[model samples]
Target: MNNKLKLSNEHTLARVLEIKHYTKALFSFKTTRPNNFKFKPGEFVMIGLIIKGEFIFRAYSICSSTWDNVLEFYSIKVPNGPFTSFLQKITTDSSIIIKTKSTGTLVLNALTLGKRLFLLCTGTGIAPFISIISEPGTYIKYNEVILVLTCRYSQELQYFNYKVKQMLKQPYIKLYARNKLRLYLSTTKGSYPYSGRITWLIKSGMLIADLKAYNFNRMDKFMICGSQQMILDVVNLLRSIGYLEGAINNPQDFVYERAFVS
Candidate 1:
């Protein structure tokens, strides 16, 4: 008559460490990582909770640096979502199930050498980019790293702001990436320093003004993660300018992965 929940054959049970709510729809949580669980920054793994005696899982980008002892995830609370609705209710000390297989194309290994690296995202797509920038490899590979994040409201940008500030203040990061990392933000539905779709910004040359470059050349590498439409639009835009898609086996000018499955 044992009632203890048994760990699934393919998943590991992780203890939640902390949780922070950014808005009604967005939140982030940290969970203890398995000592043997290893993954590159920018990769993703399936995570979920048991509901109605069944486990429901969803792919989530690992937001924490690879070096972090705890795993972190940024999530959107979709109303009636199969997993999120339940996930949003998670609290510290709760159990989270994580699949060990972490895979994605957003890692640094998928991009060729370039002088500048652009990390473009919208909403929770910013998750993978957070991991990338925190990894020292990002700073060592490029002289400049540009991070652009667009959200529906200014409040949604708070998590990014905090991470960016922390990255800049760290002695190690400051020494290597000081004055090299740049953050651009836009709020689509509210007033912010920037307001507009990132694609429009790129097409209108406004983003380029900040880039201080007229064209996207081979010297620039782009890692994009966001909505399907956003990924498509940016991919087309980059292709129009001769940027080629890259992969682990054949690194090229750019790489991308969907932030969430639509």
Candidate 2:
């Protein structure tokens, strides 16, 4: 009998290191990164498990920094989801398939020069921003880094709240991230202190007023990720205000990635 793990040329096996369940429907996991795996901070890669000799994969944005030894991902558990149903059952003893290639429009190279960098996201959309802010270069590139995260419930905001605190305490980027990095959280449901969708906040000028910053201008760069509807709304709003969508080959004022909404 042969008990060797077999993967395609584009995939590799990675060992699960840790898993944390934030809520019944939301969880995060860490895995040992392959030495050869290379990716930008805001990129995502396909990950999955081999079930019954069939590979089932899903695109998950990486939540860890490029310099980190391990790779982390934030995920939402869809009831009976083809890949997530089995992923939620994984343990530290299990191994998952990781595709080596990573790609996304949220990378730093996609944006032109800007003074303030705004990372707008909702729910698990916060995943890529985690990696983006964790990179030391992010602070150096912009004078201010603002992260606006919105969720349906306050409980969904806990993970990022904790992560932001930790980033402020990390020695390597502590000084750079101290006052430069700011976090704004909101909940669409419940009576949370800040309650509203990000689109509403921006449209009403409350987002800038709350931050006590200047109004949206060409000097500001935006990276937006979230549900399809949220992305569309934000993109439309930005476009109306003269913000151009950026790409790898064409750097512009803003970039957006449609996160895995399921």
Candidate 3:
């Protein structure tokens, strides 16, 4: 093993605390965070492992809340993927590499004050929103927080449903957000409580009706994370209704980040 190809040990060794396989293709894992590791709830950081003296890494959203003791991540195991292939084989106490810096456009700071915050996501894109909804800022900033998740199968929704139910049981979360938080789990290829693309549901006005939300007022803000296609389609949908893109420096109506680069 060449020392030149090895990762540095200064601020980035994350020991795996636990791993949960949600499905054949999806999983979630928690790791020991460095005492100095700091990040907003909805940001992403480079997570990796040293393989045969080579450092291989990818950007992963932190699925755990900032207040949580350990860092958590939700991921998709691409069968032959260079990174995930090795990642999925890890067991308890395995050491993983994490880059010190974390950043993303999905944080609540990227959007201005609003009465309602809509988190639109698909598949693993739901990772960041999980952190967002778990944070105290989400409940304080908006009267309501809506999580809209669309996947191809109903079973894929299990992880989120379980987490939400667990969060609901937390005394503080339930007290502040029991009625304010909402989850809309939908599937496109499987029979579920809600079926069809979120774009269509938004266009058909069924989403608002289901929530019985006040008319899409100017105070509504949106944060979108998903495939490029899903993000683009939803952008068009929001724009058609007078929404605008936002950023940290110039917070506007909505913000978005690509779920995966490929």
lDDT of 1 at 234: 89
Q: If the candidates were sorted by their lDDT against the true structure, best first, what order would they fall in?
A: 2, 1, 3
lDDT of 2 by residue, 19-101 (tens): 99998899999999987788998999999887766777888999998988999999899998888899999999998889988
Q: After superposition, how far is residue 66 of candidate 3 from its true place, in Å?
A: 0.9
Tens digit of lDDT per residue, candidate 1, span 148-188? 89988999998888877877787776787777788888889
lDDT of 3 by residue, 104-140 (tens): 8777887889999999999999989988888877999
Off by over 4 Å in 3: 9-11, 258-262
Among all candidates shown, the one with the greatest lDDT: 2
> Cα deviation of 29 in candidate 1 (Å)?
0.3
| Cα lDDT, model 2, residue 148 | 96
Model 1: how far residue 67 lies from native, Å: 1.0
Q: Lowest-lDDT window of 10 residues in candidate 3?
A: 1-10
Candidates 1 and 2: which is better by TM-score?
A: 2
Ranking under TM-score, best-scoring first? 2, 3, 1
Clashes of each: 0, 0, 0
